[model samples]
Target: MPYLNITEVESGVTSLAAAFPATDLIELPEPTFEGRTCHALRIGTHRLEPKPAVVLIGGAHAREWGSCEILVNLAADLLHAHAGGTGLAYGGTSFTSAQVRAIMEKLDVVVFPLVNPDGRHYSQTVDPMWRRNRNPAQSGGNPAAVGVDLNRNYDHLFDYRTAFHPSAPVQVSDNPANPDQVYQGPEPFSEPEPRNVRWLLDHFVRTRWFVDVHSYTQKMLYVWGDDHNQSVDPAKNFRNPLFDGKRGLKDGLLYAEFIEKGDADDSAVLAERFCEALKGVRGKKYSPEPGFDLYPTCGTSDDYTYARHIVSGQEEEKILAFTVEWGMDFHPPWAEMEKIVLDVDAGLVQFCLTALA
Candidate 1:
């Protein structure tokens, strides 16, 4: 079970759509810095109708091989089960044919398995630990500044110095030299990888759920990445300029991102459900926690998706966004990676089923 290369993964998306009439191949408008185009598969019964969509994206870091594989497999399993009218079972976890059909008929399961093809190519061929996109325009002739951390290039609090406390452990760097390996980029959405994700969400319009899949931690994380979540103080939120310098502080009262009590509860419940399903598929223990529990991050995709309705001033549902860090390493052994794929595919099936409730 060797990992699929970037070409194979991209071709896999096209193959899924070609094999299953229910799946449509979505061509992203922007090409990568290396002039490589990205593709996404939208699977469902109704392609034109407005419906709830569960967007599963991966390969942002490039080195995390399992993320892309898990998503591709999930899409294949759903399409296969729906088309054949057969049940899908992964180890101890099983979904009936009816459940699979409901998923296709009721929800749009959009899988963007590879976000940074150029970075993935570099990681596989040259650097096994490469973690960012290969865009050297801002490198300033410094070899180390060859890439921008796609994860930190989103627009949510891109200005970390103004948005976070001086002592906050925010992981972002503005320097194009990018020595920290977590550069925030010259501006938000500066690179095409993250812009592709933003475009996908905007194009879909009805996407109510989003999961930016990553690795090296067996955790299911929910929104409010910059600070602890609080529903009590609406004015002390990320949009409020008054709390700019006080944000991301661990001191409870100092600052906390505001999320409505119901939204917070929904995020927690769904995350727990996702973890529970993954555990059922081979008894892998996956914990549900806040995104900040990993660290205080700025300009992350999950936080940006969750903040869309609040910040965009557009008519959109408050998306319940998540980040599922699968397995225990960036690149796990192929034998172990096979099992991890099944574990997460099962979890995603349960997530789609739960979304209908």
Candidate 2:
């Protein structure tokens, strides 16, 4: 199964709305950068009141074109669920509209769908593995500085190291025209792309499930990015404490993440919560509690969402957020990707459904 090109994904989003007119779809204009205009999709929120919002974003990495497809397919499934009055689907499992919508009402569902449009375009047109923006900042003598890793450019933990480039690694970058790895540029929030993400997160404070979909890792990561947060309070309170006292494989994964970070406090019990929410799935494989731990990162969407909720001064109370890394190279012809989409989509939607319910 070939991955979806950007235009095909856009058409998919449009078709979703066409299929379900009761749902309102809005395309948020992207801030202009280097002469091109950027934009994102705003879906749902039609008849539901102050619904619990979930932000679904994808393709921050240039080469991971499959993420955009997974998102589009999920949107299409959601549309079908919308018009047909069925619940969200998995291989054989189905969660209901009344059940799911009841959960969604608690949090309005907002999906960015795809973020690195230019990089994505570059991937489709120029390089299959391109990872940054189309801006010229990465060109000239600084060719390696091609694309600012949009994922790494966020205001939160802006200096946190990336999983791939702990220190800057010079490769034939996806945005080949650019230079600089961990090249934050002349100023903070310098890139309009990540800044837009900041603005988007700010726009929806009540979001219960915050997901930034990416490829290459078959894992879902949650809150308190970077060692900075750990060193600061050490009070797991900064996270959304939904997974406390939870059990099972999924919970085990969540617990292992927390336990490893030395954050075994009550707030670190998210594993339990995640597992509880995922209790219905059968015949699925999940890692048992392992000593293998996820390295901490800063300025991540996860940390930002958690911070928004935990801090009440100007932010909303703890809203749940997770960085959903579906799998490496899960791009597709629909058949191959469906399992990945259906599996993670089930978990992502169920999280929101439970939060809103």
Candidate 3:
């Protein structure tokens, strides 16, 4: 059975701790965010050897089990690769067990697989597809049930898209104050989970490839989502069945190829690169376009991470910050979910190797 409880997660952490000094559990204090405190189990790399660090995160949204599942799978792989040797070309790349172990020696891997544990707990006990921290205020007379949508609550583009897009593709919601969904809270970092995430990243993750995993999409998402401009969106632009064509315009269509990790690209660059990469694979079914179809939602962690780690700093080379939407969150049948999980895991691993490696 899949591990579903915090107790199980704790056991996983403990196992890592016993095996390597690289692993440690981090707790997020309460009241800062209405959800359960998150934990970051860091896998250390030997000091003499230097390898790229990757931060894996999941459970930002309650129903998105695929994210955490992938994270857990990767964790298991790392442990196995460390203990023995297994990662081979069956994965399509030259990632051997020895190489994985060597990579572990040089690289530090940190993961916070469960970001909104309270919300996830509620999802398990209450609604299987629940998305948001459990605030539980809404009742007979309650006006709203808006709990902070961790996916929407990041510090970057903190715009409240739910407020504007009442009829968005994803209809899942609760009263803003309901604490069940769509509640961004009084401000960004208002919730403990997010605050702790910010605190940890700010203090610990100096420079790294940070991925905030989400689910239910066939494609991997990169950056620049708040604006909703069709042109200035990510690779997803090509995925749009309605996308017109690549206008040979570098403005927003295909610009990611030019980005040099820490190139300090603006929202424009991020979106451009994302769309450009997708355009190549979309084939004739989809075409690259301009303008962000997605509106400008602020306080988004992707935007925040991009700005802080890639856009602003000069000391570090470049940090690739990404918001990976695995797939739609509400697909029925467990088998379908398993397929998506595999695709997402495999595709993302390839993407990381190609994009960040």
Candidate 4:
């Protein structure tokens, strides 16, 4: 499958609503730097009422075109199954018509297939590796200095003092410039793209699951990307109560501890199920791990969504968030595109089924 341009993706989403009258194609109020419209496709039954909801977002990093395809195709498959009164079989698990309809009635699946339209257009038309939004404001209105890494522009754990240099505190640039690939803008939610995402999360009360789709790493990552510890309070001291005095450091370090144990465990199990479904299709393996385990990144969408409930003292309402990295590389060749889509689509379907269970 050839990578879809911004216009094609938008049209594809709109066409879904046209093809299936039950589906809704909503245009987000915020526009990109290039004046491209941001759209979200809401599909499933009981959309008007509150229900268990899943939000699937892609193209946050414009060059990861595969993510967009997987989401759009998934939406299409679901709509097809629902409208035709047919079932779907994936990863050896059968989703009966009854089960599918039950999920639709009880779950709302909203997909923002393409989040950064301007950056995606730039990547597809101008540069094949453009990883940020085409926001020239970061570069002081310099056209060449365009882009703000949308992934890093979220509100959770935003380190404006340190900027892009995650490891070192060494001052590189006085201003928030795209000097490197991971420029985190002047402040959190600085870019409109991610702010729109935040808006969706805020308004959608039933959003229980959130998956930020990206390409190339072949992993499913869960929250707390800012640091090793999962605790919302950075200064909170932690000591392993179970640690015996004889084994190593007596003073328990406040590192990599999960603030919410039950939530973490449940999220881990769901991710494992997703990986299992992926392997069921052609035996492709996708590792399930924490986001910080891969690398320490601040202000990621996954962390922002997951941590919001915890920070707000609403642990029961915490959204189970994950970043799904599909395929083996950012730009998987056309030869592998279809299979990649199928594999990911299976995993996603399994994820939705798990929600119902």
Candidate 5:
């Protein structure tokens, strides 16, 4: 199956859903600007009420075709394993059928295999470098300049004031009209793509973990993408105390404190486990670090999901969010895609196992 286009992705998802009747294939509330349906393949149910849920999202950036394939294949593997009543082997570890069923029974696994359908279609058919959704409204009605980096369109820590770093030689754009890289929309959750993602996270109250899959970097990234310091001590790192009152600097400080003293250690441990499983296949290495370690980014889905728990003050239900960067380039060669998908699938399986463990 060709993984470069949205049609193939949709077909694969449909086939999987047909094969696994238990899987719920849900279309997002709204379609992309190009009228392409964005589907979320949900495995398992919420009837158990508040089960630990893990959401795996891919194709956020249109050009990263490999990410979508990895997610689809992973979902298929799980469904096939359940259907055949067979165990799954990964990272030299085998999961028994009972264990697999336990995971399915206890966790609500939601996979948005292709988050940006319009962009995927555009990249596969038109430009292979398209990185955003085809939302012409954001481009002053100019079709050529229509695209919002969905990765930077999430709601949490979305204020451009905190995210925008004017001093950095390379920075995300505040102006949508500029039409350079990293054009965050006029406001947070401004685009339908991100709104769909937010809708999923909000509707699924049991989502305790999230993984936003992307490609070419081969890294496992944790939250707080706006800050580069891996070990940012909240006490000394928070410079803006009263910049915009309680909802502004105060909230930011509290977020930083949670990062430093509460979530960082556990998040790093989960990332390390994921990287270890990934390396087990073909000896591929993946660096495990904070998201900003690669570069400062804001409005990212992973960070937003992580912040959801922090902001809610739900310590017990804190969502462990991550961004898994696959392969070494945005568009890796077709011949190399199998190994890439297998490696990521193994890592993701291990991640789910860890969550259930």
Candidate 6:
């Protein structure tokens, strides 16, 4: 099948819920700037209390067409396999029937296939390179100033100028006139897209894992995006005011975000499992690394999800977050994206299995 259009993607969510007995459709509380209602699917057995949840979201960047497809297909595969008592085969990687059943029974697998439908609709119809949600609050009648980079609108060092050193290579901008696509919104969680994601994280209090799916890097990256990770000094972290202007300097000893040694190790271990599972599908080697290894990014989804517990002083469970950049282009052809979707679906299946264990 061709890449799903924005309408079909939302329809896919509703159809999945309608077709499957174990799935429930959750309407996000707010509509997008374009008045599109986004939904998430909760796939698990109905119970009194919640299970340890795994949230896999996609379509953050409008041009990355395959991310949402991968997630929708993954949800379908899991539900079908569990119902039929069969296994799932994606190229060479296969998941057992029991394993699929355990995932359905033991964990609440939440798949939000599309996060920015407005941007996606615009990209599919008008500009294939569009990367932000279609919110014109800051547009000021300039056609180019029509959107906010939803990925960078999260609440992790969102004030990049104050959060990073002058020399750091952070790919974010607050200027509406600057045509670079990574506009970090007027404020943290300013756009409805990121706010909807935040709602999922908040409403699903037991969500322990998150993966904000993206494209074109073939990487599975973990947290500490603001700078290199350091487990030694807990006081020199993102929440600490002492290191406000010292972050984002790669290869510099001035500041490194502090993650617990065990948490850091767990992040790396799960990243490797995702990479390995993807490799098993088609022999495509995916690098597992820290998010800062790519570049300094403030207000990214992965960093924000993982930082919530740290910034909240242990009030919330620490979500082991990741960004799985699949494929080698923002929007690959259907011939190529079809394969990448399977590769990522296999990885997500493995990720859920690992979380269950």
lDDT of 2 by residue, 1-357 (tens): 567777677677677667665455655546435444444555564554565577777877777776777677766666567666778757555678886556433445666666777777788888776676766664565655566667655555343222223332212123333433334443446677776676777676556556777765555555544322232333333232442232112212332222223332322334333333333444344221111234444445565665553355543444555665655463555565656666666666665555553
Stretches of candidate 3 above 4 Å error?
29-35, 47-52, 88-94, 136-146, 159-180, 228-296, 309-318, 328-332, 351-356
Report the candidate with higher lDDT, 5 versus 6: 6
lDDT of predicted model 5? 0.77
For candidate 6, write residues 155-214 as lDDT tens digits: 989888888999999989988756778988899999889999999999999999999999
Give the 10-residue window scoring lowest on summed lDDT in candidate 5: 242-251
Candidate 2: list runs displaced more than 4 Å. 32-48, 103-106, 138-140, 159-182, 228-292, 309-312, 315-317, 330-335
Candidate with the larger TM-score of 3 and 6: 6
lDDT of 4 at 165: 27
Could you tell me which 10 consecutive residues in candidate 4 have the lowest summed lDDT?
243-252
Compose the digit string of candidate 4's lDDT tens values, residues 215-324.
87899998755434454543331222332121111132423435566777778888998999889888888999887667666678987898788678786677999999
TM-score, cand. 6 vs. native: 0.98
In Å, residue 304's CA in model 5 sits off its true spot by 1.2
TM-score of every candidate: 0.98, 0.74, 0.70, 0.88, 0.88, 0.98
lDDT of 1 by residue, 94-123 (tens): 989999999999999899999999999999
Per-residue lDDT value at 190 in model 2: 64
Q: What's model 3's TM-score?
A: 0.70
Encode model 3's per-residue lDDT on 24-64: one tens digit a residue. Answer: 56665553234344566766556434556666678778777
